[model samples]
Target: MKLIGLVRSIRALGEVAEQGSFSAAAGVLGLTQSAVSQHIAALERETGLRLVDRGTRPMALTEAGHVLVRHGRTINARLEAAEQELAEIAGHRAGRLRFGSFPTALTTFVPAALGRLRTEHPTIVLTVVDDHMQGLVPRLTDGGLDLAVVYDHEALPAATTGPLRRVHLFDDPYRVILPARHRLARRRTALSLADLADEDWVGGHSGSAWFRIVRHACRAAGFDPRIQLSSDDYRAVQAFVAAGLGVALIPGLGLVSPTAGVEVRRLRAGAPVRRISVAHLDDEGQPPGVRAMIAILVDVTSHLRRAEPRRS
Candidate 1:
């Protein structure tokens, strides 16, 4: 029998028990009294039990009728809930996307991209994680992350044999960050890498991707960086720059947007620019939503690239 048919019979039994009259139950169910009696009779024959106590003065349910009414209501409630969840999944109205990013990218670049995606696709849930390359690479390879924004220097760390693929988003040039009040900032112009050799430097952890990139840039420019303070936190470097503690070379991606309290100047001899890419497992065929997300990333990256002024 149709599930709705069973539900309707349970409703009839409940109303008959509550009102103690077939005519009253029919009025509540929007059916004629004869139709209500026929439905009750059909249910009684199907169950091989007399649901209504015909001997009673008004009409009332037998114990079997009461039991059917209770179970039917519970079944109807579960079916309704299941339908709602199925609809949500079908429409992509609710689901989660696990996203990961390196700390430096997460601070500025990732937020902008995610904000744009969220505003457009509010139903696509995102679980954002911030870790260095060492931590995130393993997770992405193990199928723990659906998407990742990874930072890659010239000499990136070794990769595990996980089925992941990458798309180049942008190559952001490194720049020199000096306090606004510093003499270099007064120039209001880009400075050569050699000009920055004598300054104190604030940096990230010794072995971090950013640390290696910055150190390499200084060495290529012909001097070792005089590191004054170092921490794993990228924001710490920004804070130190804002505090005039030292001058540091920062990746162009790190300056994706204007940050207060620090003066960002491009380097004449050029600093190391890291290649940031979006990666996902190759074997796990991306869902429609994930494909849509990749399209959004490509669109935003193109917009950012076009907005950049002619450097030559």
Candidate 2:
């Protein structure tokens, strides 16, 4: 039998053994149930031995099936290790890269990095999962994500650091937004929180990540911001600020487009900066694609940090 076909047949056999039914195995393999049945039938014809006890409720692997499955799993593991070794030498020549990231990054540096990765490794398949950092980390830990773009804040609870390696990328500082015609809009210097003590706040959702950061900073500055409207979308927040609804604090990543009537400025000091990182399984034997993705992330974020964005 051809090595590739033999591997697929063996993989299907093992999946059937673990799942207890051809239908379940088909679901896992993204194939029709009849395809799994055909693979098992072909294996039986090739081996001249019946491998399944189909009369049983969930089906059972026969003695021959069990033995083949045990050996097949070992073979599959070795093949995977060999593939990883070859990938390191060849640099993501063939394999799927499962990656994840938060929404803003998805729209920002992450997409550019993905474009470069596709250019460098055209044959590499990509699976992207876009979500919040809290949702993405667990997926990484549970083997769902091979690589992810995650962020950490010194003021916030640290990222979960077990069994995963985080490659530090860049710091995303929170910047202040003001109405274009507001008094502080003309100031070249970073604004102090006290500079807006009397202004209403157009902030993030009441209890969301950015909201908490803004609230904490305002408290540190000796006044609680009076939130007039809570909006998490940076564009909408900028629009609100432009209309003089209130001043707002937005992360640098979200400032890529500030709309027409809002001015962007830095916090003089004590601004919350989120550190971006590329995370992957640390147990080693990482796929070349994962490492390649990390390098791309670094390159993309570095450009983001250095580019002088045109003010809107």
Candidate 3:
């Protein structure tokens, strides 16, 4: 007999042993009386035993039937436990979530969102990693991560290809960071990119997306920025600007707590903006934990946007 049929037959036999009749077992198992009788007959044929005493008014299990029913009870119990576990996972009561995010986001709204998720779904196991967008995207596609928060500049949009989908979170606008003592820092109005064309620029590593966006924005202003120092760390970049090394462009999300001695100003025109998004695989349906995390992230970002200062 096929494995499926064998399992079903065993379950039907066990139900008949408990209920005392094929008709009663059919009602309990949600099968027709004929179907239950067929299952029992198939089980008896497979075992070469007369498992049921059909001469009795109510069914009675023979020695072989009693032994098989004992095993069937164990199988039914295990199947029930497995179904309960799956249901809990589907309902977000328990499961594992592998999540990822970029550095700035990790330091900003991501933590708050994660904290809320933990509070709401305490049984969910969370594993988080911080990496750049380039690193995060590949992990999402390869099934290494369940969800990730990533960003892309207007100048260079994210390549969200191949079984991945993204939901936009918010736009992180770029602000020019100048040394507190610098001439541009004293200006009351927003500074144009052209205003800093002749100044030395502090930026991200040479080949990074951040650096590329900076270069793109500078070129749009008709001048290539003279980047004198480079660092991936936003704090270090701000420190470079503070020490009068050069001016730099930092995103709003990256300036959670601005370091001392730097003046952050809005761009008068042509400011580069990073589009933040939460990405996941384009599966048939997202797991409940993943869906909950996405919702928390959106709420966190909404509160952050509202709390941000109106002025640059």
Q: Identify the leading candidate in terms of TM-score.
A: 3
Pairs of residues at least 3 apart in sequence or in different chains that clash in candidate 1 = none
Candidate ordering by lDDT (highest first): 3, 2, 1
lDDT values, one for every candidate: 0.75, 0.81, 0.84
lDDT of 1: 0.75
Q: Which stretches of candidate 2 lie over 4 Å from their true place?
A: 1-93, 158-163, 304-312
**How many clashing pairs in candidate 3?**
0
Top candidate when judged by lDDT against the true structure:
3
All candidates: CA RMSD in angstroms? 17.4, 9.0, 17.2
**lDDT per residue, candidate 2, 1-312, as tens digits?**
788888899889989988989999999999999999999998999999999999996888999999888777656755665675587577765677889998888988888899999999887788999887667877776566788988766444445433468898877878888999999999998888889889999998875667877888888888899999998777788889999899988888898877898899987666766777888767567776887898888877786556533322
The ten-residue window of minimal lDDT in model 3 covers 154-163
Candidate 3 ranges beyond 4 A from true positions: 1-93, 157-163, 304-312
| lDDT digits (tens) for residues 166-247 of candidate 3 | 8878888789999999988889999899999999999998778798888998999999999899999999999888999999
Candidates 2 and 3, the one with greater TM-score: 3
lDDT tens per residue, model 1, 174-292 = 78888888888888667998998899999877877778888887888899899999976556777888898998877766666645789888776555777667887774446545676
